[model samples]
Target: MKIFSNPNISKVMKIYEKSKKHTSEGVKETDYSKDKLELSNNAKELQIALKAYKNLPEIREEKVKEIKDRIQQGSYNVAGKEIAEKILQGVQIDKKI
Candidate 1:
């Protein structure tokens, strides 16, 4: 119960100083307007993505069985180059973003 007896004093003070520096650097109260705009944009983006996914193709149960059957029959082929090309395209697109 003595002052300065706690060894955590220096640790707490160091953390506090760091946080204070960050606040002085640029921290400000949250802006509801900008936050709401960003959230709405995110929701719109997610909805668009979901719609795109649904529109892409129906590659389920029947497709899975077909692929499995083909593979078991030793005729299942994969175009690795196409996959690599698509991946590279994605990377390029991300860089543009």
Candidate 2:
């Protein structure tokens, strides 16, 4: 039941002792008195835009009602070519990722 006799345990103990010695000798203390953060012009603009977007409604009810009316009037059409092109674009984007 002697664990130190194992080669792996001996190697681990040697590494731990080396790390302990390295850490104990002349380590300087870090200062945590003051913290500062400054945002760039572009970052500030982005934050403002994000805040405006968050204030907007999640769903545009007017647009949804208009589309619903178009469908009821039998005028709402989906182009196959456009759908195919979008599918191809999505596949290409997925491959890039």
Candidate 3:
């Protein structure tokens, strides 16, 4: 049997050959380098500042001692209006959330 004698078979064979050639031509050899990270001067300074900030004490002991002394002297007074305002502000923030 002569398969090429059939016009449809010949057309399909030509398409298969062309597809093989196109696919072979499309083959690419790629070379990849390892990814790198480079920090700017500002970034380096920020990292150092962050490290120092993290090393700092969370609470101010000197301020706490001064406040304690004032409270002992019966002079550490907070206004009622200020306390009410803070409470109201907290309530408004809670409502927003």
* lDDT of the candidates, in the order given: 0.85, 0.93, 0.94
**Model 2: lDDT to the true structure:** 0.93
Tens-digit lDDT string for candidate 2 (1-97): 9999999999999999999987876364544578889999999999999999999999999999999999999999989999999999999999999
Off by over 4 Å in 1: 1-59, 89-97
Error of 3 at 10 (Å): 7.8
Which candidate number has the best TM-score? 2
Q: Give one digit per residue, the lDDT tens place, for model 1 in 1-97.
A: 7656787987898899999988876746544454343458889999999999988767678889999999999999889998899999999999999
* lDDT (tens digit, per residue) of candidate 3 on 1-97: 9988999998999999999988877775445679999999999999999999999999999999999999999999999999999999999999999
Model 2: worst 10 consecutive residues (lDDT sum)? 24-33
The CA lDDT at 96 in model 1 is 100
Can you tell me which runs of candidate 3 are displaced by over 4 Å? 1-28, 74-97
For model 3 the TM-score comes to 0.47
Clash pairs, model 2 backbone: none
Model 3 alpha-carbon miss at residue 19, Å: 6.2
Misplaced by over 4 Å in model 2 are 1-33, 88-97
Question: Model 2, residue 46: what's the lDDT?
Answer: 100
